[model samples]
Target: MASSPLGRPTRGTTGTNRLRRNDRWIAAADAFRRAADPLVVDLGYGASGVTAFELATRLQRVRADAEVRGLEIDPARVATATAQLEEVRAGATSFPADLRVSFARGGFEVPLPDGRRAAVIRAMNVLRQYDESDVAAAWRAMAARLAPDGLLVEGTCDEIGRVASWIDVDAAGAPQRFTLSLRLADLERPSIVAERLPKALIHRNVPGERVHALLVDLDREWDRAAALSTFGATQRFLAAVSALRDQGWAVQGGRSRWRLGELTLPWAAVSPLP
Candidate 1:
């Protein structure tokens, strides 16, 4: 018999639009846009396949052929998602009737039929339960299933999807970038993302850690940019991010992405201390 799925069940927490930020990020990713086969996997998609449906809906706008495969370790979750998909197919749900989405039983192994490799594997909030030591192995298992130049996006987000952060891992299982995205409206500090960080950097947010230092500088600059709040939260965030770059953080992206409350940096900039 085939080996069992390679991960534990998730907490099953999910809500509509809870992963909207990540979906937007993935939809804009080159891995999906330029893939010969835009097969994306929503690994460990919690108790609901709503995320998968939403992902496909968003991606279809960019690539009509984009397909999403929602994978769960629990057979019951798979059944439930399959049932929901039936509703979608019948036009009882808001999703398109021809939405290219499917559900299956899988985990980090990311079993795909016909030996098809994925262009992008998104694992939001999936690794929060695993030990930090388990992160590298999980990354390898998931990344190994990627097509050439594919991407593995792993991260955590809040229940309402207001605050989020994720890492981009290449097919080699090597992390490339770290990104923090938030809802700038009514935001207190950028460091709020520390709570929802990926397992790899969650516990590393302490003194002397690069991530810790990044958050500290981010918060400090946000405070210093308080004068710009009168213009709007977006202005304040832009000023703060510009200040971070001035301070030599090597912040990525231009004003467009920053206006969306996103800050990205090379993974090495915030990698855990040795």
Candidate 2:
């Protein structure tokens, strides 16, 4: 049997709850919870599989039958993750019993047994090492491994998960929405997420681009809603998002998600400049 094509390995830096925002967003997504097979893939889960385990825990809250599988191009990383799973099974760690998580040695091809497909694939910080031009090919490859009603979430975030952004793609490999999550305690501007945008939109954060205008408008609204901060950052964010929606920016989700420092907008509202 021929081995799968090996893609570039990531820095492999990961920590507990490093992807909490993304996992929470996925758990709340109707598509993820409604899938018959709620299998989630944590692509490039780094040197440790803790994030994958955490993802399983978060999703299981919404869909009790959810399962998480961590994939890494490096076989050694897979071995490490497997060992971590064993420790969890033996009650050596604080892992939950309902947390069904596993590890696999795979690449962008997403080699899985029995032609299994996933309902959601979270590829965080995996594409930061690759050229921006290669993102579409990787997206297509991973999207191909999805179940009919699946999602491909790809993005980057800061080391401690303070700031993050991702693009959601459907099983058909079409980009749907872009989301940004941040720690708003002392957030200076909403455009700070520009640095963490997915590879597809990071470069497009410039004048004349839809994404650029969106971020600019977001910051403007954030400033305008500063009065709401007297109530809370969440309130201010919700108000800002509401303002964006009123301005015709297709902003999705409501106060429930906004409270967690999350804002999602349609891809067309931030598509790259031609």
Candidate 3:
């Protein structure tokens, strides 16, 4: 018998624009830009197909021929999302009638047609339910299906999309970088993204962990840049991230991304210690 789909069913909580930031990051990644086949999979798109639909809409901007396949283990969810395609075809929704998007029943075993590997496999919020020890195995399973330069973006976010963070895994199944993307408006502290850390790091936020220290320093820097808030959150965030860089953190993404409330750090910077 075939192995079961690799994840539990999520409540499928998602909203309009909920994943816009994630989509933006994917579009900017090298994997999406150079994919032999611009095939993006929205793995585990829950009960609501809106996120999958939205993902296709956003990715199409990067590659006009980009095709998105929303995969769900639950056949009911697949059926529901597939039905929504009719609305787009009929021009009932904002999506173009011919948008190259489809839905199917699948889980960690991506189930792409023709043994085609994806250039981007975004499993957002899919691994939150699995044990941390199970994460590496699941990642290996999914990453095995990527084209050479493909990416596996696996992370989580808050219900309303205010705070988000994800890990970028390479086709070799090695965790590469961790990124924190937030709304930044009325933000209390940059470390609030701790709540949305990837499953591997979420429970490892104790004092001795690298992630905890990062958060501690981020909160401190955010406080230090309080004066910059007079200039706006963007200015404050830039100063704060700059401070981290000065202190020797392998911070990635400059003003442009920071201004948008995103900060990326090398995987080693916050990887959980053995």
Candidate 4:
């Protein structure tokens, strides 16, 4: 029942695999697989529908009946993406035919055909244009349209998908966890992701804050783990995260996720700037 303040349109930059990290995480989450209604919405999928098509392909591996709909505020983008979808279909591009990917013109209202409720909504890089104050309201608005037990994955990422962070929100609009995914090769400090943090924590990366301290500590551990570089960047990152856990931070997940360049922490550990 809420709505965005409706800011000016974005440049609509997009590309294939730009959201691969988020898509892969969503596909593996129990939230998507357990849903009776396997409808997923790719909100504000930019000028291209490549991410939406990729989302459908990834989700279908878990829920074969899954459907992905790409929503854009600009009608022209919607039309363009629709035409592209037709071409892919006509060429027998090996996409999930039963997945039924489509595009529609809609803003944060998330207009869906037949008033269907979504089992999951992935709104990546869509809110970077809005003021931080609008984030909670936007989450409430979108989460309200989710089916019971649905999830709302909202966050931002850098170009080329090298660094990304997202918050997992429940149907009640409460943030459950924050996940940061990055590429560890040519390694710099892990905290470099502070620049790419979600809108909520981007500005909170300063002294005295938990996020700031977390990043600081992560950098320290990363330096200490530099000795593990002999094994590889992945191994060094695993060691850094392990050190973070040993330091009593409520870091979640295990080596499997860490090896994939991801680190998920409880939201309470790093809320937002005051």
What C-alpha lDDT do the candidate models reach, one value each? 0.95, 0.88, 0.89, 0.85
Q: What's the residue-level lDDT of 79 in candidate 1?
A: 97
lDDT (Cα, tens digit) per residue for candidate 2, span 48-142: 99999999988888878999988998889989999989888988888885478988888788877777899899999999888888988899999
Which candidate's TM-score is highest? Answer: 1
Q: How displaced is residue 84 in candidate 3, in Å?
A: 0.6
lDDT of 3 by residue, 1-274 (tens): 1147766777777778788889899888889988889899999888778887888888888789888989888888888887888888999998888989998888888888888999999998888888999999999999999999899999998887889999999999999999999888789998889889999999999999999999999999999989998888888989999999999999998889998999999999999999
Model with the higher lDDT, candidate 3 or 4: 3
Segments in model 2 whose C-alpha atoms lie over 4 Å from true places: none
Better of 2 and 3 by lDDT: 3
Weakest lDDT window of 10 consecutive positions for candidate 3: 1-10
Cα deviation of 164 in candidate 3 (Å)? 0.4
Where does candidate 2 have its weakest 10-residue lDDT segment? 1-10
For TM-score, candidate 1 versus 4, the one ahead is 1
Distance (Å) between predicted and true CA of 158, model 4?
1.1
Mark the regions of model 3 whose C-alpha exceeds 4 Å error after superposition.
1-4
Q: Give TM-scores for every candidate, taking all chains together and pairing residue i with residue i.
A: 0.99, 0.95, 0.97, 0.94
